[model samples]
Target chain A: MRGYAEDKDAYLKRLRRVEGQIRGLQRMIDEDEYCIDVLTQVGAVTKALQAVSLGLLEDHLEHCVAEALAEGGEVADEKLREANQAIARLVRS
Target chain B: MRGYAEDKDAYLKRLRRVEGQIRGLQRMIDEDEYCIDVLTQVGAVTKALQAVSLGLLEDHLEHCVAEALAEGGEVADEKLREANQAIARLVRS
Candidate 1:
């Protein structure tokens, strides 16, 4: 099972909400919303997605990485590197 | 103006599609979709979001970072650091 398998439902639900927010943003743009206003919505969408990413990262660290570390050896090292890379990507985003 | 101001519409449009994909994943889950199938949708959503992130990053580098670099000085340094951090985060993700 995936690291986030336990919280799969929650993740999906959160994504759904973010998705709705995105749609709302598009509508705002279509309505010829003020530039800053549209940008604000964009910011909101970005934040929401970021939140989801953080949650997934936390879950991965708690479960996948933890499990890999417990197992030890090459797999553990790989997992650690993977986690670090994932974190770096998130930070950049 | 924001670095991505020129492609704001494109960014918004891509986000809208991602949002729809998220909704579709949710619906699939609600309908008792197979685990792997649902997970597949989740993967699709993740990839879509990543694509958007990459595009935004590209725009930032091409515009914001470039402009800042041209100005030179403290602002340029700040922009460079910000871009590096952003890239790191993306890699981690």
Candidate 2:
């Protein structure tokens, strides 16, 4: 299993919460909530999602990446590259 | 300025990379890239965003939340609540 596999339940739970927030956001839009209020909620949701992402990344680094490095060689190199690519994509976003 | 303020440049750079990945994904769709390949890229993008989110959350915890806790009292309570709410939203998502 992947490194994050162990914490999969926690990740799913976090994602579910984010899903709820999105629904709430949609509701606010439908209700014609004040623009700033809606924006504030949007910010809140974004921050929440970010937290989840960070936790997953940490798991990936500690588990998957760490294991791959211990093994060493081409696979390790590939894993490291994959991680860098992931980070690069993340930073760019 | 907040806890993440110190790493703001790094964050922005990461975000920019993600943005590029998104554009690449869009182009892939436009050019009719293989469905599986497109999905793979999408997965990559999601993971990337998650990394950025995690970094931001760490900063928030280490900086804003920590600061509030240090001060104590009503302000601390409010800050803690806000952080919990943020976490709740993230978990749900």
Question: Compared with the true structure, what per-residue lDDT tens digits does model 2 show for residues A1-93?
Answer: 555556655655665565565566455545545333443565665566456556656667787778889999998998788877666654554
* Candidate 2 chain B weakest lDDT stretch, 10 residues: B30-39
DockQ of each candidate, alpha-carbon based: 0.15, 0.04
Give the chain B TM-score achieved by candidate 2. Answer: 0.94
Please give, for residues B28-56, the per-residue lDDT of candidate 2 as tens digits: 54554533344356566556645655665
TM-score of 2: 0.52
- As for model 2, its CA RMSD to the true structure in angstroms is 11.6
RMSD of each: 7.6, 11.6
Report the first chain's TM-score for all candidates: 0.94, 0.93
